[model samples]
Target: MPKNGAPTRTRILDAAEALVIDHGYAATSVDDVIAASASSKGAFFHHFASKQALADALVERYVAADLEMLDSGLAAARAAGPDPAVRAVAFLDHFVGLADGLMGEQSGCLYAAVLTERQLLTSQTSAPIATAIRAWRDGFAALLREALPAGSPIDVDDLADHVFVTFEGAFLLARSTEDPSHLRRQLGVLRALVETALAAGPQEERR
Candidate 1:
């Protein structure tokens, strides 16, 4: 194993994630990662027990990064104000900034990459990915609760799910059209949707 074990492990993971996102999990071999990272098999095994272990580590790292983004972005966005409309606008605006930063890198969703070759993955990898995605959903739902008109008729869970839908849809369209700005453009529309929902107001109290 190399003396720079941590850097070597990170190098392998970085190379593997890129390959998996581009070519998929099944197609990316251990030797491919070793060569891509410019590390030997000794360094590889010193870090990971096997190829599957490497995949698990990749999923864990990806999920951890995503959750950090989710939490931090929501905090910054919600800091806009106490008003629901203001919060909604702030959230979307923050997301647009996020989208702009992530534009050309839209094809690199680790969850999407893992699912694209799910049969080759273990439950250890799949379960955490699902949980992380749901964390995204639930986190957005919390934002919606703060942003939407209290007691509005809209299903908060369903509305929250649309956040992911819009992102995934935007990513696909961007890829097909080679339009880098598509995501930012679509996220801009989400503010209007929230505003409309906010104005809808609470329904008549159930007797």
Candidate 2:
């Protein structure tokens, strides 16, 4: 819409993301993205080498966007000196809001769809997904670790991993059921878990 090549590239990725969410990786072809994006084949190839490369680029773009959103709200909450529980709630609020919009779409998570046919993605493509997942987990772990009292023995990394998987699973269920309530219910459970984990850490810890 910008009437420029950069916008064209973005359009290509946006179209590819939707198509991948709708049709999936193997089912989607380069021609599909070009057509959906209203861009030329040359333009598509100029941006990516192959369909695999395009998928990788899409994943990278998607993850970067998500991380940016998480950082923006979490950083604000940290600076405001909110207690760990409040900060945790703020984090989930931001995260759930993002996922809610994505789930509200007819097409669900682009990566989750591609994950069904993950074999199609080479290691190069998978690496970004793995990295994004790890970074998200680490971010949560850091928050939880800070929330805990001094010398608490809880394993924040493991807890964050569990929470991440729970969140992803809930999103999958919500998408499959076309029920946003599934995600909301799961977030409630997670919020309780975060509070319990923090409370169980140390008695001296306070807001």
Candidate 3:
């Protein structure tokens, strides 16, 4: 629906995404996005049918970028070694480093910010957000499964969910407390949990 050039659209999205991260979705208006983008009202409406349409586009763009980053980290970790357990530890190390770097720069996760406003969003606007979250969880679960020895006592799927939860919590805590070390400590706990599980070896089923 955007009548303007791709550059114009990107500009609008870029401006809008930054505002949403700093100001939450409910507080960000179309006019605000237009003003930030330095585009005319017509240009804004042309690219997006409505404010919700803009929201959907932003979520899609952010989610895609997030997945790409995660995939890159995973690939790097996998390349570090052939053993699943080793790769698993490498993945956590890579992820922790990524988190530390982002926190160091004080960059908040867009998906986490938007999720807090989900009640204000329509299904059309929220579906992509949910899908992105699921993809993240599934990706981590796959890595955990690969890393754990067969019959390991720890539940790979559950641990993956915990990883997601812990990261989100860490972000909230770090932002609220103005301390990136909160996230670092949480990642430490995550590494410890993974290491403990790996050391436990496979478990036998009880009769």
Give the alpha-carbon lDDT of every model.
0.80, 0.74, 0.79
Q: Taking the tens digit of each residue's C-alpha lDDT, what string does model 3 give over 68-187? A: 877876797679888877877787788777777878754566777677786545456667767766876787788788877778877777887776677778988887888887777898
TM-scores of all candidate predictions against the true structure: 0.87, 0.81, 0.85
Q: Tens-digit lDDT track for model 2 on 119-157? A: 655457666777777887888887877787677667778
Model 3 stretches with alpha carbons more than 4 Å out: 1-6, 104-106, 118-121, 202-207
Candidate 1 to truth, TM: 0.87
By lDDT, rank the candidates, best first: 1, 3, 2
Provide the lowest-lDDT 10-residue window in model 2. 98-107
Tell me model 3's lDDT, rounded to 2 decimals.
Answer: 0.79
Off by over 4 Å in 2: 1-6, 80-82, 97-99, 118-121, 149-153, 201-207
Give every collision pair in model 3: 2-47
Q: What is the lDDT of residue 200 in candidate 2?
A: 70
TM-score of 2: 0.81
Model 2 Cα shift for residue 190 (angstroms):
0.4
Candidate 1 lDDT over residue span 1-207, tens digit each: 555566888989988998887778988999999988889999899999998899899998988987888787678766987775676567677788889688756465667778767574546678887787798789778878876776789998888777777777787777789887878888878767877887887889879
Query: Which residue pairs come into collision in candidate 2?
Result: none
